[model samples]
Structures are given as structure tokens and as C-alpha cells.
Target: MKALIPTGDPAEPVVLADVPEPVPRANEALVKVEAFSVNRGETFKLEAPAPGDRPGKDIAGLVVQPAADGTGPAGIARVVGHPMAGGWAELAAVPADALAVLPDTVSALQGAALPLAGLTALRLLRTAGPVLGRRVLVTGASGGVGHFVTELAAAAGAEVTAVTRDAARGARLTELGAAAIVHDPADARGPYDIVLESTGGETLPVALARLARRGTLVWFGQASRTPATLDFFDFFDGPESAVIRHFHYLDADTGLGDDLAALVRLTAEGRLHPEIGRVADWADTATVLTDLRDRRIRGKAVLTLS
Candidate 1:
């Protein structure tokens, strides 16, 4: 089996190898991985699979065996919480409960991109309640995470205001259901109900100033490649003005099952459309990662295993 292995290099992980196939212990499933995608931002925290390890977060495939990790199977509770590893190979073993069966309505490439970005958007928009009819401001609306949030918010009936700097993609953003698209990075037309901040760095502070009183701000990812710096008290400083809720997708983890299932169902029903910017084969993984690390791609990039 050929798996993408991470070399200890901080710049980018090397994908090369003919490794052994993994066997499911208990409550696990062996998925014949058809396709997978790379979350370029993941390189910040995780290197790659060690010599004996596998790397892949978002995946789409079929189950060939059951679990061996002492967990149960055939339930939505199990499949969405913890996604199986090894999405970069032709076949990899994942916990059965971690699997979200892809709907026939979506393609393998689309299915592969669904697990992470889709789940993040669902968690922000659907989990714990609803944000329908509210006003949402999604920063970085032209990118993967940002674009998904825009669609999910609009789907829930929220008047979405997508913030973007890409002039070429403004029309696409409108097609994705953004009530409005603005190129101004720091401009805030507040009274915003929900603000999803995908851009950090200096933009983080600017975003902090735009939220409506008691507004919920969810930080899904920092695509700007810069850490956020701000005085938290400024927003909360004026008790009458607003509230701040900073977060990472994994911050409030619920086993990842329900969220993934929700995304899959939406895709299967043709209600959800994930933006996939590039689809590269396993051999091109290196060049793709380099491109992503340097911010060369627009939307999520999928890597297929043959």
C-alpha cells in the first residue's frame, strides 16, 4: 500500500512509501480509500504520518472489515465523532463508527472534501441550535472554510454577508448565497448577528470590533498565516456592546459523527455543495502541498489515491 508519510520537515511533509495495510481491531472498518483531500492548514500542527504511520484527515471510501478497537458499529453516533486515519492511501483502516457513508449524489472527490470543512461549517451553523434568518458575516468568504460557512448560513435562512478580497470570485460568492459581497477587509457594516472569522493576524482585531452586541464570533481557522492579537476586553469591555466566542473546529468536539452525517445528508440531497479548487493525483501531492503552503490555491484541494 502507498501512503503519504510526513518527513519531520516543517516546510512541507513528503509523501512517499509502500507501507503495510492496517487491520481493524474492534469497532473499526477497513476502508478502500477512493479519494482524499489535504487541509493545508493542518501542516501547522501535525507533521505527517511517521514511517509506520498514515496521514489523512478528510476521506471517502468503502468499508471492507469491522472494528477491533472495542467500539460499536452501524450507528450515527460512532461514525461522525472520530474519523479514521490514512486517507492518502488506496486502502486504510478506520474505526467503523468513524465512517460517514458518502451519499450517491456526491462525487468521490467531493465526498473526500466533505469531512473536515463541511463538518466545521455544520458545527458553526447547525449544532446546538439554529441561526436561520439571522445576519451572518463570514470573513475570507472566498476560501474553502469561509465559502462553506457562507453556504450553510444562507441555507439556514440567514442573510449572509460574505467578506472577501478576491474580485474574480465575487460573482461565485453571490451564487453561493451571500446576500452581499464586500472587498473591504476592515470595513464592518455591523449589527452583525453571527460573525465567523476565518482570517486572523491584524484582521482578527478588526473583526473583533465588528460584532453586534451579544453577537457570536466563531474562529474556524487562521488562513492569514498570522496569529491573532487583540485586547479581549475591548468588545466585552463595553458590556452593552457585544460578546466574543473564539474557537477552533476541534475546540468543542462531539465525536465528529453527527456533524459529518449532517454534511453527507446535505450533499446527498444536493442541498450542500463543497467548493473543491484542485484535484491532484498521489504523485503530485508534493507540488500540491507546496502550493497550498504558499497560499497558491483558492478552495480546498483534493488528492486522489489510485
Candidate 2:
């Protein structure tokens, strides 16, 4: 099988190489991947992609081999899931607990876009508790995970405010339920009950400061490529102290599979829309990776196997 592997170098980080078929464990299923999406974290080149390091997490495909112990969904079902490794390949070995069966109405590409970003947004908002009638702010509102966060927050009845670099690019955000779309993060009113921060760096402090007293700020991504520095007063001078929490998709230990299933169902029902900025074949993996790394794509970038 042909799989995408990181070259362990920044100049040219990923490459397409022929790899062996994955053997499933008792608790794992082997999926014939139909499509997958690239994530910003995968573009960081944080570490060298060792030999056989398949660098994809979100995948939508068919279950070629079910878990031997019957712990996984039976083989042959179309599913959307997060595979810890080997997701960028023609075949992936995913834990049974990490995947969910896709509804008939959902396509492979849409399913591919759901697992990572969708799950992240769902988990982040859940941390903020019920968003109904609460002031919710989403940064990087036009990006992958940010898009889901925006839509989910709005759908939850939160008074959603989306911050994007380009107002023109956010027309769809209003439809997704954004009460206000501002080009400048500072332009939006602050003291929000929940702030979903995907843009780190200088934006971090601004987001933190915008929180309502005792509000929660969920910091997830650092697209700005700048370090976050906070002054002493920024932390304690406020009327009431706010809380900053860090969220990672992997740490979502509870109901991981159930959440993915719900997101897929929502999309299938037309209640949730996972944006796909671009779609290309596996042969164009390198170019897609470069585009995502450079912030050239506004939404989730998907790659198809066929």
C-alpha cells in the first residue's frame, strides 16, 4: 500500500512511499482509507517522521478487517474515525474505540473532515459547560477546528462571536450562527463567558482578557507562530480571575467514539457542516501539506484515495 510519511525535515516534510498492509489487533480494525484531512499540528515538523511514521489522524473509509475479538464494528461498514497512526495510508489500523459508523447520507470526504477537528470543537465547548445564552467567542474562526467550534457554539444557543483575519471570508460564518464577525479580534466586545482560542501568541492575552469574570478560555492552537507572554497585571488586576484551560484531542478519554458518531450523525442530518477548503488525490500530498503549513487554505484540506 502507498502511504504518506514525513521526511523528518522542514524543507520537505512529507513524502509518499509504499508500505505494508497493517495487521489488526484484537481490539483494532484495519480500514481501507478512502479520504483523510491534514491538521495544522501535523505541519509543525515537531519531530522527524521516523521510517513508517504515517502522519495522519482523521480518516473516513471502509472496515476491511474487523477486530478479532469482536470489540470493533464489524468489517465492511463505512466509518469515520481517528487513527493514532497510519491514517495517511491506503489502509490504517485504528483502535475500535476510535471509530464510528457513518450514516448513509455522509460522504467519505465529509467524514474525513469530522474526526479530529469536529471532536476537538465538541470537547472544547463541552468544557465551557452549557453555552446556551452565554457569550461565546471563537478565534481563528475561519480555520478547520475553529469552523466547527463556531458552528457548534452557535447551534448550542450561545451568543456566538467569531474573530477572523478577513471579514470577507467569513460570510458563511454568519449562516453558521455567528452573531458578529469581526476582522480585528479587538473590535468584538469582550467579557465573554467562553472563549475558544485557536490563534495563540499575541492573540492569547487578548483572548484571555476578553473573558468574563471567572470565564473559561480554551487554548488549542498557535497559528501565529509567536510565543504568548503575559504581564503580571494581566493575570490579577481584573475584577475577578478568569480560568485558562488547555485542550488536546488525544486527552479526550471518555466517549471518544460516541462523540465521533454523533458528529457524523449531525452532519448526515444537515445540522453540522464540516468545511473542506480543498481536495486532492494522494499523489498531491506534498503540495497539500505545504499549502496547509503556509496557511494557504482557509478550511479543512482533504485528500482522496481514489
Candidate 3:
């Protein structure tokens, strides 16, 4: 079998090399991967990869073998799966609970884009409770998860304000249902009922200050790679009841298979769109990863088996 493995070389971080095939556990299904998406976090790991690290998370494929425990989709089924690692390979052993059967309406590329980013958006909105008629702000609105957050939040009846500096992305964000577009968080109108913030550093505090009374600010990522410094007194200036919550997509009690099914259903219904900014053959994984790390790619990047 061929898989992408970390080379521990900064100049060439990942390389396609022959590797032993994965043996699935009783609760895991063996998938023949057709496509997979690259994420920002994976790019960071490639920068300082450890020996024997196989990096991949989002995969879409055919289930060649079902779990021995009789869970997950039965027979040969088209599915989207969230594996912890080693998805960038000819095959992957995915937990049955993390696999979702995809409708014929959705393509492998779209399925590959849904797991991590889509789940993050879905779970975050769930955590925020009902958003109907509320004021919602999505920072880093042009990225994969941010794009999903903007669309899903708007669809749920929230008046969504998306923050992104790129003119091109701003235009697309508007098309995706963002009610307003701001170049920076500082420029956005405040008293937002809910805020989904990923860009860290200065943007975090600015977004925090805009919260409405009892508003919740969900912090998910620090794309800027800069630490945020918040003054304890600043909390006094905002709504006294406002809350700041840290979010991790996997922490939710909802099963991954169920959440992924929701996302896939929405895509099939044309209610959600996965913004695929780049697509390439798996042979070019290294180059595609470089572009992702440099921020040259705007949304999810998918690589096909070719």
C-alpha cells in the first residue's frame, strides 16, 4: 500500500512511500479512499513532523469492508469518514461511528470537505442554541469552517455578519448568506448575540467586546498563530453576563456519524455548500500542503486518488 508519511525534513515534509496496510479493528471499517481534504492543522503538523507520523483526517470513499461488530453501513457503500490519522492513503481503517453514508447527490470532493470543517460549524451552532432572529458574527469567515459557520448560521435565521479582508472572499461570503461583510472585527457593529471567532491575537478581544447581554463568544482556533492577551478589566466594560466559551468539535455528546449525516443531508438539499478552493492529484500533496500553510488557498483543499 502507498501512504503519505512524514519525512522529518523541513524542505520536504511529506512523501508518498510504500507502507504496510492498516488492519481494522472489530469496530472499524476498511475504506478504499477516493479523495481526502487537507486542513490547516495538518499543515502545522507537517512543519515539525515526528517520525512515523501519518497525517490525514477527512476522507470519502467506498466501504470495501464493514466493521466486524455489524455497525456502520452494510455492503459496499459510499461514505464520508473522519479518521484520526492515515486517511491520505489507498485505504484507511475508520471507526464505524465516524462513518456516514453519502447521498448520490453529493460528490466525493464534497464529502471529503464536510467532516472536520462542517462538523465544527454544526457543533458550534448547536452549542449556541437556537439562533433564529439573533445577531451572529463569524470571524475568519473565509476559511473552511468559517464559511460553513456563516452559511449555517444564516440559514438558521440569524443575521450573520462575516469578517474577512479579501475582497473576493467577502463577495462570496455575501452570496453564502452573510448579511454584512467587514474587513476587520473592529469595524463590525456590536451587541451581537452570538460570535464565532477563530482568528486569535487582537481579533479575539475586539470580537469579545461586541457581545450583547448574555451573548456567547465561542473561541475555536487561533489561525493567526499569535497568543491573545485579554485584560481582566475589559470584561467589566462589556455586558456583565456575556460569556466566553472554548470549543472543540469532538467534545460534543452527539455522535460523529449523526452530525456528519446532517451535514451530508444539508448538502444534498442544497442548504449547505462546501467551498472547495483547491483540488489536485494526490501526487501533488506536498505542493498543495505548502500552499495551504502559506494561506494561498482560501477554503478546503481536496486531493483525489487520480
Best by lDDT: 3
Best by TM-score: 3
- Per-residue error for 8 in candidate 3, Å, reads 3.3
State the lDDT of candidate 2 residue by residue for 30-137, as single tens digits. 999999998877887524565556688999999989988887688799999898878999999999998999878999999999988899888888777899999988
10 residues in a row with least lDDT, candidate 3: 6-15
Question: Candidate 1 — worst ten consecutive residues by lDDT sum?
Answer: 73-82
Global CA lDDT of candidate 2, please?
0.85
For model 1, residues 161-205, the per-residue Cα lDDT tens digits are: 888877666778788888888886566576677778878888766
Q: Which stretches of model 2 miss by more than 4 angstroms?
A: none
CA lDDT, every model vs. true structure: 0.71, 0.85, 0.93
Can you tell me which runs of candidate 3 are displaced by over 4 Å? none
Estimate the TM-score of every prediction: 0.87, 0.95, 0.98
Selected candidate, larger TM-score, 2 vs 3: 3
Clashes of 1: 17
